[model samples]
Target chain A: MANEKRVISVIVMNESSVLARITSMFAARGYNIESLTVAPIPDSDMSHITIATNGSSKVMEQITKQLHKLIPVYKVIEHEEMVEKEMVLAKFPIAENLADISVLASAYNGGVVNVGKEMIIVMAADEPKRVKHFIEAAQRYNPCEIIRGGVVAIER
Target chain B: MQMSGAQMVCEAIIAEGVKTVFGYPGGAIMHVYDEIYKQDGFEHILNRHEQAAVHAADGYARATGEVGVAMVTSGPGFTNAVTGLATAYMDSIPLVVISGQVPLSLIGTDGFQEIDAVGISRPCTKHNFLVRSIEELPRILKEAFYLARTGRPGPVLVDIPKDITVETGEFKYPESVNIPSYKPTYKGNKKQIVKAVEAIKNAKKPLLYIGGGAVLSDAYKLIREMAEKTKIPVVETLMARGVMGHDHPQLLGMLGMHGNYASNMAMSETDLIISLGARFDDRVTGKLSEFAKYADIIHVDIDPANIAKLVDVQYPIVGDVKQVLEEMLPLLEGVDPDRYQAWREILKRYDELHPQSYIDSDEVIKPQWAIERLGELVGEDAIITSDVGQHQMWAAQHYPFDRPRQWINSGGLGTMGFGFPAAIGAKKAHPEKTVINITGDGSILMNMQELVTAAEYDIPVINVILNNHFLGMVRQWQTFFYEKRYSETDLTFQPNWKALAEACGGIGYDVTTKEEFDAALKDAIKQNKVCFMNVSVNRFENVLPMVPAGGALFNMMLPSPELADSALEDKKGTK
Candidate 1:
């Protein structure tokens, strides 16, 4: 049950300490968050936040309800059907086979976005699950560094 | 219409219909206190400590069903009120604490009497605000009131910086708040309500498990109607002590750790449980896996998170308890009552077999006897508050509370010093009603300084001290669980409470016998001013019918052999 991942998007008033209030609630309840991201919405005094956590249906329900209780939180959306994405950038040594890395990244709807003298930078923007798998598959190319962005979600 | 933050606070409080606030003043909060001094129509009860102020405010809120307000300074002042805030938070009482903070610039620089007021109080509060500007003071204050008193009420805190309190800003108290996410669901889902009603009607053994939520939501009348219409037996949790009259045939006494035997047994045997506003707390549920193992639970609570948090709720109705009960009552009419009669008879037999009785000794006064006698004199309608311990359990067991809010105790947090200050708050809210604080030796000393507050303010709340000269509850636990290694539970060096009360300008009495107790209690009630009565009780006595921690509710430990013999003798005499 703990392995089942849940994605929840919270719309909140863009204010100081608002994020603390929401995150503290989850911490107080001892809920674990796997990945989180927050950014201000365009042309509004609000922010969009996405949290990925592992819990059963019951824990997810509790997390959602508690999030709704926070003052700054305008809405809590537990995605039943949604388009979610995570970005990962992997830098591989230039001497490593570039053709094989491109094929592996392309399989996950991703490809090399940059080619440098010292390293080849590959970017993958796909489902969080696939992005996770892509990182595991590209680990063999002697990747110098890997950066994983937090999950960002939108309702379909 | 420009005003300082302090003045706007006063304005917002007035606009929010807050006529009274319990608080203590200090350097950090001087501006607000100064404003309070200049303002009219607000009664401020200055308590000895910040902790007691919050407790008094909590007591006021619980007794009056209004949002109680408490104000204090920064740093140590806010930290001192942490226990009171936690108590109110656990019990879901509506309270607002306004604290002073260091000026915005010195917030993180470690200035004099500065602490992270909001951060320290975050976990214990339902929500909190740290005022960064004077312009937002009015809105924050308004929101604080709304949040504290709204659905599943809990405490909220507002921390104001010293500079903000002095800075002037345009004061426009909003006529209404627009928190779209904070709306509480009042109307229960129709499908769930119907399903719960059907389950109740068809079940052979149905029980109504009432909690503090039922009392807070004022669902007593609706609960009674549902019980009578459906012929279902009802059992209450500690917080829902007076859900039904003590003499009601269908009303089983409280269930759980210190609950009545028959009620606990009935809970184990029930086929369906109609839970109203009561969370399945550890104390109430005992062993989680063993709690109501055979029954299908129908949970009706306003907080969606509360549903199925512990027990698997078969029918979850997310709404206010009162509104849900109102909607479910009509659906329960004309339900066949024959099936429940047999279950009722079985429960009646269980009650008859093990009546809740305690040892009555003629040589020494017993705590149970003192409480029973006190109940007779005070009557069921009198408001009673209790500190946590053996005395609290005795009071809950012996006192017959006939109305909602009549019996107020620190249920969830079980804070020891909660009784006296809370009784002061209750008495202040209901000036004509008699308010009694049933306290113990250890608990009375926790916040005994509040006696000066009562004496100064002319709040005539009766303090009944069951002086056993030991921390009775811990002593009992040590005796049972720790192999009689009584660590630091002994409290023989306690102060002379009677002399202390007298020194504080309150009348005091020392009673050792039942006759003396009766006389002293009557005298205290008649005096009409602040009075404290110290009733000496047997130091070794333990609360009977106690369910050991993690023990099944149905499997309760009864009185020991010596006490059992005394109880039998007393029963024979009564017969």
Candidate 2:
């Protein structure tokens, strides 16, 4: 069987050496991390780091343990059971029928936020994988801007 | 400690250690340029063309591993930089080409030089930006530099409008970048590393397949150490040529269409394959389904999607080569080889069956011999650039390099005018190093304006034109594949070599014979000016190991077996 992948969330001081040290761990030891996400904690001084890596359960546990040991790490949680969502805001041409775009957006938990004289801004929040599909389908409307927000997850 | 976004961008670039920039000035970018002029650290090389500016920056980046920097005005200036930016992006080189945009007040109202630079470069760049305010310039520039230099390195363009550059407020460059979805994996899995180690230990015949990643990630030393420890033979891809010492006892030389017999034999026989840093391009693996059926392959790379895209990968490690090797090194401390005695014998037999050797014809000086002489004289260390043609094929076939960046060519882009400008750029990047631009008469003529750049810089780049009086590769295509009805391949005439060089303010020589070529090359290397040698060659020279359009590597047009036989017959007839 293939190794299981772990998604570990790291809370840390939003500082320089933290990212450098974290990446240096990967670079120096040659450890392969599958996916990584980092964002500031809204109004807090700390940043939230979400790292996804494939390994056995033991290795996953060890990884989380080691991450917690790092100097800047404030919290480490393995997202074994979580409701994860990702957001993507796309600006499509105003020429596309508004009704069709609204229907597409609402279905993905989104809607048209604004309709300037020349442009339409549509924001969508969905499962990360589904967000990719939404972006792919939205290509028909001829998107001018695509801004993908960091994935945020909370344990189910 | 604090400034506006525009000031932050400047500070970030300074931190990145960029010493020079090439750009064309304009009104839209006056704010940034004003900040630039006020700064006292770096000088900008003003280019006559925006496209040339980006190309020079790209050339600088490829020549030096440092990120190449360029700036251009809005709209058309940005568009011109796009082509050069795309070129660097496609080749996976680190470049930062910043462009100016119209002010926010004039952004949507058909402002002058206000093309949507970010939108235009979306597909061409790793990442790009349009700063809405001066407050974020520091963060954006820091992120741009980080993104440009990380993972599979490529171009990143930051488009700042004039007003934002002038707007000032509290500013501080971010200490770190936090892009959520763009994490690149490094380091091999311990289990897979063990599996690979066990496979290597058990395989009767194991081969360590090398690729350009070795050179790019600076994994040559580790790869060498691993090969030595495991006693495995090494076969390099086109880009992986100089990653290992070619003369190593375990090195089987290059693999793929024109790969040496030893390399091909090793690939065909080995039961275990460890691909370090190469994408198995079709040129290397002829028929994917039928490629190395005997082998259990392990592919280690940074791009995850590339894992099982082609052939079946038994063990896939997605990570940076340098990081992966560093982790896997200690695991291979004392590994011992267990098999391959009989397989080596069979490879030796294949080596005897399909040997590679050059021919001597009394009538025409062979192109292959010239390349061999170039390799022998220049040694493998000189930076060699080639224009896309049959000569490119011959050089790939003959020249042996063991590192990544030592040999520069337009592989993915296969651009015609690449050699001249690229050589000048490489020379400019490393003024102390010897840069050789090898081109066909047709290919060299494509971007011959760069001869001015070489001359203006007073950079002595040796331009060796394999002048066959026709677009050699195209003519060869017509000869064998297209039924030999040579159409526009033939070129009628031009000024003599000395005259052309004199016209261009450089040194040039017309070499009609091998003796003339040897003497001219020696003198050309010693000259102070950019030297161009137009070597007159027999028009019918063809590159063997030809993979027709979409064919596999194994299916090659072997070198004409008739040359040797015809030579013997010619001697007999003369007698």
Candidate 3:
């Protein structure tokens, strides 16, 4: 098998040296992390980092094993049985014939499209993979610009 | 309806999603207690001491992967929590510790029960607050929970003056925390991630040195795959045991101080050390400056402060271990299979040569035999919690843990009284799994109070004291370093362990010989009650296949060729 991907959720202390220590560790180690998202947790002094990475089972095992060694690390967790969700927003040129695609945006967990004078914007919230798929599917629509948000997860 | 400040705090706690709080009640916290009675839905587990409460909370947090909440009162109540709170800080268990300070007007006056809870707990807690107003209650409560559970989570303390709870404000829980200085980096830098890939592709002998970070990052699967695909051998620190299947051929076992001779030797030989999530603790590195002298180290971790702290690194990837691994997976091109052939061969030679030899000549009871049989009989999956001593080292050396978090010890803190309570916590965490506390006699007695905690909770964590009737580790140092002064090492005060267990409301047994141990363990495993077995042997028994403190991994104490020959000759002569 090539490799499997793992979804890791990091609850971190947001600090100046914090991000540098974590990323440098990853880069220096040569472990491949696939998806990365960092956002402050709701109503707290910490940030939750959700990362998606692909590796052989052993490599991934080595990765999580190392996470425990970091000093600033509070708790390193990966959701075995969790509910993961991601969101995305895309702005398509109004002239690109996106008027009929409003329903497509809602098909994903997104809706409430805003039509402005210069551009048309659509937003979707869905599973991370599905959102990735939506972004790929929306690519042919001649998107004037696209922005994808990182994933957020909570345990079931 | 009138309510105590303590009661309001409890209600707010319940509202904040806490179902359990571990603490002991005292005069300073009497008001808090008044409120605790009015509260429902949240379970309040009364620990024997404030320390136990914090430890239990930590245990709960680790097992449940949620922020653990603990509460205590000022003075001794606050002081007693230091060990457990520090334990959490060291181990990175997320906890929200709520302490009751003296009434606001009496705060600095050092009232009879007053102590500077915040100042006292400064080094241990991630962040702390002394609430001055009732208006700050909701935000403080909200912030406490937020602080405990978020970025690089650690224990956070919120000290509430008794009066603040009496005061009230509109309870507004903020939707998001806006701390300008605190931002955790989750994603690895695109440029660094790319450079790491290139390094891996080019390195001749790329090895993965794993620590607890891999499990913390939840990248076990990714780690395993990366190892198998790249065929990178893994060297796990003692803390990282069970992050991967021990049976994995690529795994080289625990590395560092008492690490396998082969693994340490390999570290000297390997070109690149791909360290993820693990720090360069002294135990893992004989001397920090001399560690992995042969390797160009690559470190990947979610905590930015850990990178290049101990060892200078060629590349540092700061992001969650899981995230960093995903990015490097595809970029790694296949390296030659035989790249590490010579190193692997040498390691295999060391493994075959050393073979963890032990002195079996003595017909009397031996410590190594007991540990080996227990390890074999209990099976590799049995959770082995140990107190600090020679036995802890022996267990770490001999036992094979094929599960993550299975081997729980007081690794960084080296707390002696850790095993029994930790076993209790771990048992509570994984009730189905067989939890065993392998402690030295000296260490076991330190927290023997928790015997009642286990009995009260009906938590049957098997307590196996490697009883040597002395502080074995200390005594060993006396024997080895202090020139046999033996000083305060003896444990003459120990009551008959079997009788002691029965008095404490548990089953008890004793084993004197290996044969008796084999027979006793069969029934011991099935016993429905908490049990203690006094496996008696000579007090002089020592764990061999030894590495002395601050010594090189390769030098000394492996059955000196003459020692091995004499042992065989002595056995033949005895026969």
Candidate 4:
């Protein structure tokens, strides 16, 4: 079976080593996470962890079962139908064409997040797939550095 | 009322009706051990090793159908228990492991005996916790037991900082816990139950495939009732060994790899497979595509993920097996007496054609013969536990367990040293029952130190070692697949087990002949103190009627030399 990308978000108690446990479990299985993100759920003693990995359906089932078995994990949601997004910030010399970078950011439903004397930081928030495309398209502008926040998803 | 976290730990476990705990004390857990010492209700067994402590707890849980509890110190003490935790987890045995952690200030600072207990155990345990505060200690401890014993029943670990154990807090043991997301489905869906009944009614050649879940849910009687009511021949998995009577007329022996020919063949040809409390493990479902290819699988389990997880299950009923069977029995109301008479005749023919048999030797005792003899001597009521490998398979095949929990072994993890400590725990749970650890030369060496503990505690359990001088199971695999490339499977340097037992203040016997074995076993049972009987068996004799891994269940390798050779030649593409 060919490996396919899968995103799973786990709701877990905000406690020590929970993240280490989750990540090590994936590592033990030799399943690499393409992207990962963790943030405490507002007004709750829990956190939401989103992990993106590639595996076959069978492998995915095993991973899901393994995740569900973790002690702190309360819920594991597979992003079958969900709103997924990623944010990428691209930096360019202030001398670079500002109009082109602005158009590129706007195309990805984003805009300039910060500006400095020597460089311009443009941020784009969009679906993870489009975010990858945006980074590729912005490469023509001779970007200095690119910072990416990992993929996050919520059920639609 | 205000209570120290250590006192709360005692209260919480006492509230759960825990009468015994298996553990080893160390610096990190000194405070909790102090409280345990002060506590009057709990009977604590100090194991020589942390691994055995967990296995003992697992044994206690399996025997009593209650949550088994084990405690250990941080770092290596906790790490040693990973195998035991994983063993219980895979088999869905209820166990709660209480691990001592460094104080909060010392955590993650490379403090003495510091380790990420929760992280290390997360994969193996069903759930784990790090108590951050004393107030949460009681609730977390309570939850640990609750989660360990509820739902599909598995191992849970709670890592407590030493400071928390010494710290004081208001103690309030919650009458109940309501985890919003953790409620397990108990009642099977009525519509699904009805659909299963309809499928059963339509199946001419139906097979009842029971797993450990039936035993865990105490549904053995219900399973037997259902099987008898429907006249469906039953096939049990390794964990489900004692769930059905060994000699039940309608029962085909265990199924899948190393399963009986009649059972495996019946499974392959059956039109429907009613799987209760058993996952379709790869070992049970050899060559998945060819396993029960003709059958519509009706899977009934407490865990929803288990259903249709491996193979396609047609009718998935998610609930406790005992409760589901209760609902299902009325639906089956009555079945035709002659419905599967022809199917039964076919199974009977297969049983007669390929009966489980082995050649007897006067010089060297056969492992199978020793097990059969032990079975005869122990009667049907003895609670038997086994270490993993050839010995375990022999025990399952040779011994006829007529009740649930009568046969306990490390099924999923295939742990080697599990039998000795587990047998000890079983004896502690049922002091009147005859507890025996049927082990092997290779496996007995893994946790033989527990013999000292057994002697110290006066646990009068029998340790029957089938001395084969080699890792029998691995050697068998090598013999077949690797053309006898023995590698390091030989265990000629094994300790003189009889001498070792005697040195540990227990009686010991070394038997080389069948007659010696019978006499030694009888003598050991009569003495009623911890006894080790090392019986030398044929070193080259292999567990037979084997199903080569990834081969279809119906494609079993028989015991007869000629048949085994043909099967090997066929697998090698030389037939």
User: In order, what are the TM-scores of chain A for the candidates?
Assistant: 0.92, 0.79, 0.88, 0.97
lDDT of 1 by residue, B1-575 (tens): 99999888888888878878999999889999999999996899999999999999999999989999999999999999999999999999999999999989998999999998788788898888999888788888989998898888999999999999999999989888887667889999999999888888789988999999998998888888778877789999889988786777788888889888888998898999999989999888888878887899999999888898888989999999999988888887758878799999999998898878886789989889888887788786589999999899888888877877988999999999999999989998999898999999899989999889999999998989999888989988876788768899888886777789999989989989888998987788788878878888887787878889998877788766544333343456587
lDDT of candidate 3 over B126-192, digit per residue (tens): 6677787777566667777777766556888888887776665555556676654455677888898
* Per-residue lDDT over B1-575 for candidate 2, one digit per residue giving the tens place of the 0 to 100 score: 65655566677778888887877778877666777888977766665567667777777777777888898889998998877787777677788888888988998788767787876776677667778877677877888888888877889999988888777877666789896535565676878878876776677887889876676677889898887777777888877776776567677667776676667657766688889887877778877766777888888876654566567788888777777778777877656643555766666676677656656565666777777778888866578877788778777767655455767776655667667666766777887777888888888876676666667668688888888778878877776667668899887575476677767779989887888889988898778579788887666666665556555455555555443233343456588
Positional deviation of residue A6's Cα in model 2 after best superposition, in angstroms: 22
Which candidate has the top score in DockQ?
1
Model 1: how far is A43 from its true place, Å? 3.3
B1-575 per-residue lDDT for model 4 (tens digits): 99888888888889999999999999888888999988898899999999999999999999999999999999899999999999999999999999999999998899989998877787788888989999788788878888998899999999999999899999999989877657788999999999999988888999899999999999998898888887889999999998889889998898878888999999899999999999989998899889888999899999877977788888989899999999999889866747988999999999999887777767778888888888888867699999999989989988978899999999999999999999999999999999999999889889989988999999988999988888989988988899878899988987777789999989999999877888888788889889889988877777878989999888888887543332344455663
lDDT of each: 0.88, 0.74, 0.74, 0.89
Native-vs-model 3 lDDT?
0.74
Order by lDDT, highest first: 4, 1, 2, 3
For every model in order, what is the number of clashing pairs? 0, 14, 94, 2
Ten-residue segment with the worst summed lDDT in candidate 2 chain B? B561-570
Question: Tens-digit lDDT track for model 3 on A55-144?
Answer: 866566567755644445567786778888888889887787665568778889787478898789999998888988888888878888
Point to the candidate with the largest lDDT.
4
Per-residue C-alpha lDDT of model 1 across residues A1-156, encoded as one tens digit per residue: 555788999999998888888788888899998999999999999999999998888788888888887768898899979999999899999999999999988888889999988889998889988998998998899899999999998889
TM-score of each: 0.95, 0.75, 0.74, 0.95
